[model samples]
Target: MRGDTEWGSIPGLVRYASERYADAEAVVEGRTRITYAELGARVERSTAACMADGVRPGDRVAIWAPNTLDWIVAALGAVSAGAVLVPLNTRFKGAEASDVLRRSGARTLFVTGTFLGTSYVASLRRAMAAGGGLDALRVVVLADDAPADFRTWKDFLAEGEGVGQARVRRRWESVAGEWPSDLVYTSGTTGRPKGAVITHAQTLRAYEVWSDLAGLGTGDRYLIVNPFFHTFGYKAGVIACLTRGATMIPQPVFNVDTVLANLAAERVSVLPGPPTLLQSLLDHPARGAHDLSALRLVVTGAAVVPLRLVERLRDELRVATVLTAYGLSEASGIVTMCRRGDDPAVIAATSGRAIPGTEVRVDAPAPGEPGEVLVRGFNVMRGYWQDAAATAGTLTPDGWLRTGDVGVLDAAGNLRVTDRIKDMFIVGGFNAYPAEIEQLLGLHPDVADVAVVGVPDARLGEVGRAYVVRRAGAPLTGEDLMAWARREMANYKVPRSVEFVAELPRNASGKVVKGGLRGTPATG
Candidate 1:
């Protein structure tokens, strides 16, 4: 394959990979293994299916499924047919997913059947019914048996039967580098999720640099434990694998035993996830029995990495390369990454220097002080999908994106993330904005006021702890609040602990002083 400049569109990249590594294994999931040639063919057929369904250029297509080979094909196929892909978090409850789908105005949805005993299709139906129905959204289920109302995976693929291959080729060729590729929704400080619009060229170029820096190469087996809905798994995991000819092994969920078995069975060479994933593997009793000798590379970040975790990954796991990277959805999921051979202390202390063509600036009050991190680069998102006011608030008129993260830049340009200016805390690797959690907590009848803040944890790097003020005569407990939160939001967003107080500290402006609640005693 040619260098970065050659492939502009994702479909173009897939074509390039097929030609360069025709018979090479491209995807491995359970009993199925697909070659690059077959993968490319399937993507083309999927593109044709989308076209036949009247999916026009710039149309929004949503995928709400777990990590699987079908997810890759559907996403690539949709993008190839000039549709902007919108990935819904598998962890999202029906209402949450509906909000995103409704906001993005997605015209079509591709989902899975029962997984882990949760019927995603049923959840979606309930959400739509509750919201008075989605706007002409088409649903296609990728499983053996879908509801009578929806189309199955095979049926969806058959939509392309009558469409000519030449038509699909024309659609693929029509897509330009600057076209919108994916609309990934991230929760802002305002307590609502906004879609970050990223272009095809930006994504392809960014991950190419990522693949090179990480030393990913042909024939390397990559076990992707990261969820495909996020940029880390889709752009870095799938796109990076395609760009470098590495074989992708998609793990739907993160289980230590499954990961170990896949690593040894596939001779996995590259593995990337949050620190908790690696920690679990290290702590698992059966870890030593698994043939993890083939594990050669590891990439971890998204929370504070204890120096000991880094040391153990190398010393105990015997991995040759371990890298830490930092980026958000607005920046195409990468801003800086530690190089292959950097010192472990450096990897743990800072997220490495900005990638090529990207610049990082700290808006500090004085030298060496932490401030909001500003990023300007090719990887910067176009803007939020349609919310211009929200987009304007994030990106400056000139071009810099206000990351809402408070961090400092070293003399060498490495970024050290210290705190969040937006009060967004990462739980196990997922971002949980405090405003969103507080909004839900305030709805309880017995709660008079609530404030949420993040506290350090030994397992999950940080978990939310809420401080609440009970009504004068109401009998309310911290456990009651916790139970209510679990039903109202995603598991990661639920506060692990709650503290009931008689009153909450506030400033003259009436804003809750989050700092005062940080070290408060927990009632749970």
Candidate 2:
């Protein structure tokens, strides 16, 4: 690896993979299988196209598409051209996509027409109509050939000759001006989304450390189901394969039947995802129809995985190489992970240890008790973009990142997460941030004031519930409020129930005493 082996930089590692395993399969989606040599060729072609299209060093190229071969190709291409890559989540609506695109100041965008029943092109058109036109966005490349206003992928790829080897070599040798790579925008749980500036050095370090621990390398097959917009999919899913020359099987869209078939068809050796994704695969009625005998390693984290689901993968699926890791976007996703070949008890009980070269410390511990976690390593982000005050509050001057998570590291160096320090909760293992719910709840016509709290549940661990003060003239019942929430949010994020009250209990500073409502017997 000639490039910076830090967290954010993985281009040099990709170069290494191409050199070492040039003929091996790099990306496989549907009937398309691209070898490392072929993949690198595509990356080079796209990089040339990017440069020809006026993408420059430090420029932002937003990849706004679902998980597809083109998404990975565009990401690597933009990075190779010395442009920053900003991956947009497919879940975002037109307004959300426009906000991210506008904030990122992207010069070029690669979009898709359709994805899993979602009309992506329609959304983009709507975004443009809403005044967030692609003014700075000079080039728009469509992933699939369709009758759209954008150019086709083939035409885009042909813009640059594949003979820019000299230019690429020079740029690789003196890859200055830009910092390997940069990922902006935080998956906001609070107010608005702030860009978290992660340098290439920081990102590469996180991937290298994790790849070593997970024992990934050439000849290994890894199936990636998570979206690349998130850290878990980008670092662990994509970079892990590139750095180690392992085969990467990307799913354009998540389908239980499709995944099950691919796992068997590809003979995938390693599988990693959030608990819900894995559970859906295992619980699928057709899961047993596939031959998954080649599966050896199974890694999962992000949300609290049910013990039963873990045990089922082990007992029923016959996968012995099972491990779980913990991380946050701020830490580049995988600061701590269960070591390979550990005892089943340890694997199930703890989130493993801090990855090698990363420092993990708990601040504000209450006399032998664990408090908030603070991390220092190449994995931590540089800072929150353009928000010095918020950055100062979250990141210490000494470069330690405040994780806002409560966890204890036992004497054996294993970490056990207890709860979050902030007012947030997890529903069905997905983070149901309280601020977002409060914002949505406030939109109710009859809602005067509202506060959201997490209540304990056996199946989901914690489910969100709302307490509200209705407007005097507005006729809003608890049932109506609950129904309204269900219409706006994903099923898991919808509150289980709503309680209408005259007023909510607030402290001297106007902060609601949410703890008081947790175990209250009264509904209102």
Candidate 3:
């Protein structure tokens, strides 16, 4: 936290990390462990390759692959060559891929032929052919040798490829003027996802804050199972590892056994996963069989974790520290993180106060209550790419980002999230908090998990409907669940109907897909 310098750009962050930990392992993909020295060389070669193929400053170069070394190379390569990287979600279908590609106007895409059982090249080809300003597509670099309209990684990197420590430093100096490094598309829950234009300065500041707060250093190793498409993966996983000189264990997808095994094998010190992943790790019968003694820090977000679950982690897992982060794509990932030394109540119920440089304030408090969460920080994005109206909606005239979430700050300055402004509904002229209902429903004996949503009603104007996942071997009908809720809550708060499900639909980032569940019947 004491380190001070004027270099606030992402390329600068890469330079600093490379200089500090030149020979240290920067990333590990299965058997391949690439040191910062090697990482710099690869990024340099990859950047030169793109530049040779006519990519210029501000050109959009997309990485349309799953979590792999090639993904990191391409991302860093694009940034180094003064091209803003656009990362497409690997979970996206042809249509979704096409929309993102066309909208971003990416000139080149570094792709992996087949990753996680999906043919990325095939989908990219189809998407490109369907068209919009993608005809200028110059090169496609494949990680593995697959016969196609493209060059292999070895061949591509041969373009003006230079080696040595001196060259890596020189390559970084060439692109230091480029402010914004990546154009990332936020997972649009409503309408087409707009790209949050993140600058190099913004992203570096985010990683700096993260590195300082987590006390990360060259000795640490991070297990990154999150997808590269999300901000958490980029800022928390990629940038955090780079800034701190920590080795990154890249996983293409979340595999419970493999993740646990890697933590032991890699001796991973920093671990970040969604609550769902943590729940599985804790619930696994083989959990005690594995070695997690090396695991020191655990951080989670993307959803409100249950207090009981957090308590179990602290008590049973014997973790040194556990933190819950509150972030958004617009803010370059982390705005606030529950401090490692925070109380269990704050750790369980809130995402804690803003990080050192960020400012968080309530927009409009309801007479003696919480209000909409507003944030202002260097980490905040310049604006949504090419959508002035939507950009205006999020960024206020005073520069504060009006995050759609509602929260309250206690006397200690810990921020407790209450609900989403968009999710809140008026019921009988009174606002109903779906999160409150869902939290209560989650406490039911038969309920494994629950999500509450507002539905249009002829009489009540809008009423609550509950979607639940029953605990294993527990049987609870819709009527039984409704009756149980009625006994525990007031008439207005009790769910009018209940639907049982195996699991809730979630986005790539693991947030519940509430919009997807809107039109379904009361019981499934």
Candidate 4:
């Protein structure tokens, strides 16, 4: 059955999964294990808490945290109470996250206290500058312990106890499939991130197709190494599991040894993440020490997939199914997917055919030629949140979405994405936009100008390389600038190397010639 038809809304799915798979294990985070029944009860408490905290239908609720059971419960609880979810990237710095929450006018925020040795609450407070920037946000709940002004997870949940389950059920049942589910923010070539508004119906239908294509089943132990903020992890990993009753083991950070330990300990059967993750596992020196016979499904994309990698899984690990897919945040994060029984060569070369109800086309000379990929489907987003100009530019009046990705459509209907028209590249698994990085680099006082380009990396698939022009009389060095970048942005976005140039190459129109910058010599 179509997920939308079966459950109608996410709240409906939560209720059904709770009843049907009550005793089945739902999530495993370290020593913490929770059954489907426990997850449902937790979600219900969260929903009531949201209502108690002034969350209403159509309000925007944001969560800035990693992949954990608390993140799942807090986000779902808000959605069940009819608030549109806005998932912030855990890698984003305080200013980056603050900007989104301010733009979205998020009514409440659920954040982690400290993660990876940094205090997230303090970071956001610093970025907010004495709370002057966030007037809309009424409450801040911490997943760990409450600070001076914020509420703790325990205290937050206790407030909902006064609100009965009957009232919570009414709030959950009031949600319709047509209501907006999430506002997924994605940066474009313009150097600003825009939120893509996706509806409940689109999310449900898309991931249902994802689960069916990936062959997910009940009781399958899934180790989700992908960050929950990305659509790949949240929908394909979380939402897909809800439909199939699979066990979720969310790994907050990507560590090879931790992944191996979880796989062997939990008998993980489904592992879906970027190609780099699988490649790391295949090359890990300690891989043979773990009993990995139980691993059966692997879904990877966001970078090139070598045919040898596919062959190795079957030959060495004995995985039954391995698939690749293509998607973007604007299209509900799915476009095409490789089926279960596809040939290894085809799976490596193409992203398979379009989903059941969508149409794919390319503006090119012929089938083999490359062009801008266009899609029209139920999966396309409503539009960029409150930005009609961007919506008009992205969507045609005839209903086709102008995907900025460059791709070639074969005669067999398979899509092979070749390049990015927006100059976006995937570093490990994260999308790195050159324009965004260049803008950030321009913030340095000693830098006269900057241009960033994607450079080939053996391990990360791609990393940023910046060609910079130093201001006259400035004594800044490449080593000094790179260290500055580490403190400024996410680690993946920091350029691996930098080169000082006298001037940047540009055309008559004055746009930076990135192709020339891509050839600039690195300092190392």
Per-residue C-alpha lDDT of model 1 across residues 1-524, encoded as one tens digit per residue: 24346987998998898888889999998899999999999999999999989999999999999999999999999999999999999988888898899899999999988777789989988888887459488999998788888899899999888889899988888889999999999988779889999999999999999988898999899999999999999999999999988999999999989988998888998999999999999999998888888888998889888889899989998999999999999999999999988999999999899998999999999868899999999989999988999999999998999999999988888899999989989898888999888888899998899889999888888899999988889888888888888877889989999988879899999998999889887984
Roughly what TM-score does model 4 have, to 2 decimal places?
0.98
The C-alpha RMSD in Å for every predicted model, in order, reads 1.5, 3.1, 10.6, 1.1
Question: lDDT tens string, model 2, 400-506?
Answer: 99988888877887887777877667664466677777887898888999888888776566788888888998877777778877655545567787777778998
In order, the Cα lDDT scores of the candidates are 0.91, 0.75, 0.76, 0.91
TM-score of each prediction: 0.97, 0.90, 0.79, 0.98
What is the lDDT, from 0 to 100, of the residue 352 in candidate 4? 86
Runs of candidate 3 with Cα error greater than 4 angstroms are: 1-8, 162-171, 187-190, 423-524
Q: How many steric clashes between backbone atoms does each model show?
A: 0, 14, 1, 0
The residue ranges of model 4 lying beyond 4 angstroms of the native Cα positions read 130-132
Candidate number with the higher TM-score (1 or 4): 4
Candidates ranked, most accurate by lDDT first = 4, 1, 3, 2
Kindly report which residue stretches of model 1 are placed more than 4 angstroms away from their true locations once superposed. 1-4
Better of 1 and 2 by lDDT: 1
Q: Candidate 3's residue-wise lDDT over 249-301, tens digit each?
A: 88887888998898888888888877767887888888888888877788887
Query: What lDDT, from 0 to 1, does candidate 1 have?
Result: 0.91
**Please, what's the RMSD in Å of model 3?**
10.6
Model 2 residue 171 distance off true place after TM-score fit, in angstroms: 3.6
In candidate 4, how many Å is residue 423 off?
0.3
Which stretch of 10 consecutive residues in model 4 shows the poorest summed lDDT? Answer: 135-144
